[model samples]
Target: MNKIETVKIPRHVAIIMDGNGRWAQSRGLPRAMGHRKGVEAVREAVRVAGDTGVGFLTLFAFSSENWTRPETEVNDLMGLLKAFIRRDLAELHGENVRIRIIGARDNLRGDILPLLIEAEETTKANTGLTLVIAFNYGARDEIARAARKLAEQVAAGVLRPDQIDAVALDAQLDTQGIPDPDLVIRTSGEERLSNFLLWQAAYAELLFVPEYWPDFTRDVFYRALAVYAGRERRYGGIAAAAVTG
Candidate 1:
């Protein structure tokens, strides 16, 4: 049995699912196959997070930079995303999970936008684990969009410049009501954020594992949770003794 039950489980966990192409290349298979396998890992992660009492799980599914990839691969990914939603939506709803998406939708294709809306509408009131899918999401873009919104308000005299602070900006962000991530995990030995959740992860504990995302298993997730549970998060202020000195 896993020892994670003995430690504190994170209320929110975000993941950068990296290395699908590499995993496929290493196995002499097509990259698409790797992505398909990665979908399985996504299912497992959701199950584990739900079972372990995690309230929120945010996944970096796709990024704005991904548009520069090959067109065929992009289409394949979009197809996979649609399939995942259509196939898994019912099961997720049955499990009392709420689906939420973060990212820009203004320019999304007509077909894609509805699917995303359907997922949210279908699970709006589940009152269970909330799955946040960051599709076409970039941290910088999210921040910039928020800034633009605030700038417009300031320009229109609806708000003063001085009133625009972290709190005001956060309300404009895609993750306004969601709590910040307690832990951010990156697979495939990557130590960088890759623009996953920059502002929200300001004080998050990071864990980088060597396993490719497609190979990410329940064990790996439990181990990462264990590591997070062992850490001392001071959030800037030190102990009372250290502060006095």
Candidate 2:
């Protein structure tokens, strides 16, 4: 395998931590057990990213469509999220990791909203890698929400319809200030984005690994970064090497 180029590290990396339930079911264990184990993977990913010099790491923790799952399972997932924040917040702050949540919070449950707010507020001053948790996030929903905000601005005569270009709309996104992901990875061999970071991943290098989220390790993360380093990001233009060749 090729070595990871330290200088080529992505500024932001986003991951769709998939196949937690499947990982448990395949082992004849409860799906909740898989999610619990996946939490450990999340911890390792953060540490690895920080150590690898990744400035930002976005995790697709939960999607808006997740609400369609079984109520008991949903509740269990929520409990795990609460537990993770309560258990890891102080440690992350001490490590200089900034916590950022990018998702619609308009109607989040009372219990969940406060915890999310607390996590972000507690780590807002950190200077290290920013850990972005996309809880209840769906890229399409996020785009629509941003569009609605633009519409409202137009209605109030604060902006004109002709001025609602990509930049204008981008400013209204939940990830407004954050840079777009440089690489997007999905575990469990999932090749599709599944409504994760559609807008922000327009130019990201996408990688799909067969391991489930629970099986993700620092080694696997490092391997993915190596793959990313080898790719030539053309961004719709010919690579400089190609042009020179």
Candidate 3:
């Protein structure tokens, strides 16, 4: 079946796109090929989400620890990202997708930062979907940054000590305007968060698919949605209606 079969879409879905290097290695490629193919998967996934009317889609593009990789690979990845934004920005705007990059902007490569800003500005008013790309982003670091900013405000007497609470912290997060994900899918059979969306994913349904990111096409996305349909999300409490369907 095609990607459109994935009905009952979640409001927000986060994906941990893993296994690019491993997939490439098995094919005797230099890993860059895998990354390139994974880019195709991103497009397909976007189409499927758009078709299914998913409000928000966040892809774990690059993590804070990804900086530890060799310079060659990092450069290659950055180039691919730049190329993607340049080539896909217009198409994304045409499709009514608001392109947003959420991460430590200061840590990003200079060339990419400007392109990201332009893309965000170019698509800010789109209403179809919100695609959040996490580059140089870490949940721990985000929390720390929020805390640091709040502390500074308190020290300056601009904020009261008793006013700092979960609500206040939530509003300070990078994903302040975004809703918590209803489901999080990790490809390549990895189920762990790897420091993704710590505070936001407290009640998200986790699904680990054995397929690699490149292989995670429209069909797999539909299957995940079907699986999610069978679940009864409790969100830290019991269902009120005896939830037996």
Candidate 4:
């Protein structure tokens, strides 16, 4: 696959990493194996995004609904998340990758908080790519939280109801500093967003692939960009016709 140059690349790309369990089952291995392998895909995505000079890459690492999984799997996932943080923080910092974790940090383990703090702090000064890890995120939950905040402020007489708009609400969302996703790619042939980034991906170009997260590669990324390039993004606006020669 031909790689798209930076000039044509989307500014922000989000991904729904799916099919880990099915991938593991197909290989006669524990489901954790799929999750483990998926981490490599993440590494590749990060490196490629950095190389391509993409502004933002948000990976749906975990969602609020993922807690319904078996307790053992959940624990394993948590452990793997921690291990990834421990193993990758220094490298991310050195590579100028600013790692910012979104979603509910309250659910994260006590031990993990310090590592999260260190990771964000260490990479805070870096300027390459803003890699967002949606750990315990749900788009609905994010919007609800923002709404509640707006209501509280209104009740306190600090703001008026009409003052609320997209920019105002965006400030309250977890992805305050980051741009809304321009493209969202889901692996494992999943056609749904599964509540990944409901509010942020309002108009994002979505691409679904049959390949599972464990097997998603830079080539797949290239293919996705190619598809995106062929798309006509009207964004609810009418386009002007080209002048005849």
Candidate 5:
């Protein structure tokens, strides 16, 4: 398919990379192997998003809840993350892909902290596709953090409770300046949000595909965009042409 010519791609796309363990189990392999394979899919995803003219691609790399998994698996995931950054950082920077990481970083382990920082600092000046890696993130945690900031402002007597509107709260969010995702996708046929982008996805379209995360190919990304192109986003209003004409 001529994706750029035929599909109306969304400006920001977020993906929940699910089914790694399941995919490995299905293939009679260790879960760590599945996570390794998922990394390859991530590379293809970034490439596809850039080629398709997507301005922002936010990947749900590791959620806050992911910390509850087995220690070995969690360590494996972290290792993979570090490996990906070490291996792909220079290339991504050279290609002008800026990296933005959103999550609570105060609790990050000593060794992992520097790597994440390096990725962000190295690509902060690049102006191409903004690759947002949502590591150790949860929508509830993000919202709670935003709420705390607003509460602090009110307690300082600089802001009134009544003045705290959606815009005020949005400014305190981890995604303060980032555009809300236009499309959210979950592979492995999952139909739930799984605690991802609960606030930012207020009006985003969701597309669930049956393929596992490891099998999510560039073709699948194009297919998702094609699906999004056919949607009629009323955004709680009547047809624009009818109202304006």
Candidate 6:
């Protein structure tokens, strides 16, 4: 196992939590059981992130396409979400963790929207780790929404078309003020982004782990961090060693 180098800790870490249903099915248990266990992993991840001094932790809790799942399963997921916020919001806020929700808020269920809002409001004054929850979020949709905002400004004659560059669009994004992720880890060995944070992850170091979401532990997280520390991020430029050589 690689030792995590504290000096190289990533400022932002985003995770695509996957394979909950498979984790339960492999053990001959119901899929819902897997999701419940995944919640435990979420708690561990948050604690570990805080301890590791990761300034931002973005969790892909739910995507917009998840609504296509069976109604019963969707209900189960919703119930778990409500239960998690109700049970853990105070504890998270007390820990000085600032909660931020990023995603489309239009047409969310009445009960769920209020809980998300309350969580953010309650933790707005926190100064510790920023816990970002991507709920009902899709990168493509996010980009489109941002574009529409810019278009609206142009149509209103408040902004010119030429002024709509990346910076202007970025300010309209849900993650406007947040830094881009330095590391993106996906459990269950999945390598794809699945429409999560496509724009913000332009230069993130990607890691795909074999462990399922329910089985993801603190050790695994640390190992991922160690791997990230070993990497040399050059963005679009060449490495210094190569240039010097």
Q: Stretches of candidate 1 above 4 Å error?
A: 239-245
- Candidate that would win on TM-score: 6
Per-model CA lDDT versus the true structure:
0.94, 0.95, 0.91, 0.87, 0.93, 0.95
Please give, for residues 56-104, the per-residue lDDT of candidate 4 as tens digits.
9999998989899899999888888899998987888888899898887
lDDT of 4: 0.87
For model 6 the local lDDT of residue 160 reads 100
Candidate 6 segments whose C-alpha is farther than 4 A from its true place: 1-3
| lDDT tens readout by residue for model 2, 40-121 | 9999999999888999999999999999999999999999999999999999999999999999898798599999999999
Worst 10 residues of 5 by lDDT: 1-10
Candidate 5 per-residue lDDT over residues 1-245, each given as its tens digit: 54555558899999999998999999999999999999999999999999999999999999999999999999999999999999999999999999999988889985788999999999999999999999999999999999999999999999999999999999998887899999999999989999899999999999999999999998999888889988978778887787989
Residue 124, model 1: lDDT of: 96
Question: 233 in model 2: Cα distance from truth in Å?
Answer: 0.3
Assess the local accuracy of residue 162 in candidate 2 as a C-alpha lDDT between 0 and 100: 98
Using TM-score as the measure, name the better of candidate 1 and candidate 2: 2
Once model 1 is optimally superposed onto the true structure by TM-score, how far is the C-alpha of residue 82 displaced, in angstroms?
Answer: 0.3
Who is ahead in lDDT, 3 or 5? Answer: 5
TM-score of each: 0.96, 0.97, 0.96, 0.94, 0.96, 0.98
| RMSD of every prediction | 1.5, 1.5, 1.7, 1.9, 1.6, 1.3
Candidate 2, residue 142: Cα displacement in angstroms equals: 0.5
* Candidate 6: tens digits of C-alpha lDDT, residues 1-245: 33356689999999999999999999999999999999999999999899889999999999999999998888899999999999999999999999999999997996999999999999999999999999999999999999999999999999999999989999999998999999999999888999999999999999999999998998999999989989999999999899999
> By how many angstroms RMSD does model 4 differ from the true structure?
1.9
